[model samples]
Target: MSPGDEHDSFGGVGGSGQTRTRLPEGNSGDVYGGARRPVRSSRSLLAVVGVVVLLVAAIAFANRGGGDPADAAGTSPRKGAPAGDPTAATGVRPVKAKTGTIPTGYAHDEQGAQSAASNYAVALGSDGMFTAGPREDIVRATHDPAVADDLVKRLDASYSADFLTSIGLDENGTAPSGLTFVSRTVPVGAKVLDYTETSATVEVWCTGLLGLAGAGSTKPVTSAWFTLTEKLTWTGGDWRITSSSQTEGPTPVNGDNRASMADEIAAAVEGYGGFTYAR
Candidate 1:
């Protein structure tokens, strides 16, 4: 693993000429494009922020938020596990930055927290998010090294051997011949909940695609919704993930467009690779 375990693998904002949301129309929702899903409500949006703040507070409360003296003295939590790689600021940058419209490297406050949460969502939903190599890089980049292994292990299991094969890949995460895997999160908007110098919580509501696109492919692109609750800690002068979780929808309706041919879809997936999203 790059720096963490597989379990941690489980892990966006935007605006444009087009918009997407999770709420229904009668419910006064918003709509995001590409996938053509329903939008999130203002109250739901607030929930996103609330969830993030509570995450930090809960974790901080659990760890006593680390004494200022210990952190200030640079003797806080030890960076790694006894049997695993020592958790230290790797001093490496995240693989890439982006989530629909939100920028990476957000300001180190509530906004930054939201940015981290949003981008973390993208990282979680990204195609690379499923593979072990990129997955570990993202975990280490986004999280406190102390928790990286736990998260990685959890992710590894989440994407088990059977799961990968079912999704058209071998044990190594490679998609079957002629198939292009598509799992990406596009952010709609973001909000901040709470933040401190070393810790922050943020929520990112996102629309994602999870499936394979290819000729003769049975699994076509599909949409999903879930809020990513990310707990972030500052490391090496940048925000990284400490811990995170995912839950089901807030999903929206499917679009009216006729499904494209599997070959066309596959070609698109292969020809147009994903972006390293930036605000």
Candidate 2:
């Protein structure tokens, strides 16, 4: 696969009106024809023209830069609106239970669906997915009963002994001695495409780090962007994935920053803890 293609694939984933002028009873006839139309004075004409010109100018101004004027004014367009704060903590409490680091028992709502999707993306893109035990736990924890078994089987086949080696993992999906195999995904955001009482579809935009972090590692860690769409069901009082599919990128251009050393990357990963994402 091409470098760009390395992390791309997933097997299962108003108008205004002008004013009118009044004319004298018989003067309605035009000078050159049978009917005399009302004549407008230069000042009146200029006033009307000026209003039209101002209207056009205002429209052009609003269209300029294709962004909200409020944004240019250093404020959000949604400033006073009743919307969820992206920077604020979601006041809704987190799930109390977890299945081996994967959050469970999400509330049965759109927010719950989004939370479930974001966490599932992290689980599916984790280093655990490379191993059998954790992979089974992840799949079972996040998927609905109707499809969990099938998904586990598919994932087991996908992450085979040979597949692990291709991605710098051993036959048992372990990194070489002293090396840290990194496969992590952070959800940029999530949106519910469709929602119903029992079912919901959520799309999660994610940025991921993948590959090995250690000396002499051939596949150095790299970043990739992808969107994962999950079809979830409100089963057993929480949202669970019925199916999921992945597609590459809404990726941004790489910045001109210097690449960190392997040790730095490994240290950073070890030092930082991940978040429990919410809508």
Candidate 3:
């Protein structure tokens, strides 16, 4: 077995226009797009964010009234909660800088905290956490320097070799031939549990897909609902996760949508890219 254990991951922003194109008649090249699913990649995964998804947690926002945006430049909390709509984009550009593939350099305020929590949750829940190198980069990027090393160690133990095998992945966290392992966290909403000038606690309610996507696979990808709570501090001019935990949903009943086939799920992950939310 390769030497390594534990896990960590987290970040993002932006939406670019996608134009739909109709396929021209072709015998093979574009016919059913060659009838082959696109390759699976861990770098692109999707999540939808909303304030309403938190259920009762939405009401617990910091009740403080307005204050100066300039005041937030220091370690003091910004005046008032984030704008009227919790889901509305702040018009500020999402963080474009990245540590490895994780987004960084978020604004030092509420939107930053919320974006950090949501993106970190996605990273923590990604298939990369099942591997080592990418996992370490994710942990270090999302966490405070003081705790990042410890977190990397703890996470290594959490994603043990046995755990990896039980989930139909190799020791390196790669799925068997022709199979795709999917583990993605989609943040449904973010809510401020508490906030200070230099620190904040945010809950990111999320839905995720996990398991293997391929025929003959023992573990078929499955969906889950939960909330990821992150304690964040303004560190190095950006929000870094100080500590984190998770709890069961806030889940809603599944509507009429039927579960897609393994190939279909794999295709969707490939066709649709993820977002770097900045609300």
lDDT of 1 by residue, 62-106 (tens): 122112221111122235512212222223332234333323455
**Candidate 1 displacement at residue 248 in angstroms:** 3.1
- Model 3 Cα lDDT, one tens digit per residue, 88-149: 54577657587765678887778778777777776666666667887788778877887777
Rank order (by lDDT, best first): 2, 3, 1
Q: What is the RMSD, in Å, between candidate 2 and the native fold over all Cα?
A: 24.9
* lDDT: the better of candidates 2 and 3: 2
Best candidate, TM-score? 3
lDDT of 2 by residue, 1-279 (tens): 000111221111100111111111111111112121111111111111101001111112112223222221111224453332243345676465677677788877877787788777776666677678977887788777776666566556656686577667788889999888776776776778889999898877666666678888766665545567777888888888776655545544444356778888778666666666655
Candidate 3: residue 170 Cα off by (Å):
0.9
lDDT of 1 at 27: 16
Q: Say which candidate scores most in lDDT.
A: 2
Tell me each candidate's RMSD, in Å, in order.
15.8, 24.9, 15.1
Per-model TM against the reference = 0.60, 0.69, 0.70
- Stretches of candidate 1 off by over 4 Å are 1-106, 273-279
- Model 2: worst 10 consecutive residues (lDDT sum): 45-54
Clashing pairs in 2: 13-244, 13-245, 13-246, 28-36, 29-35, 29-36, 30-35, 30-36
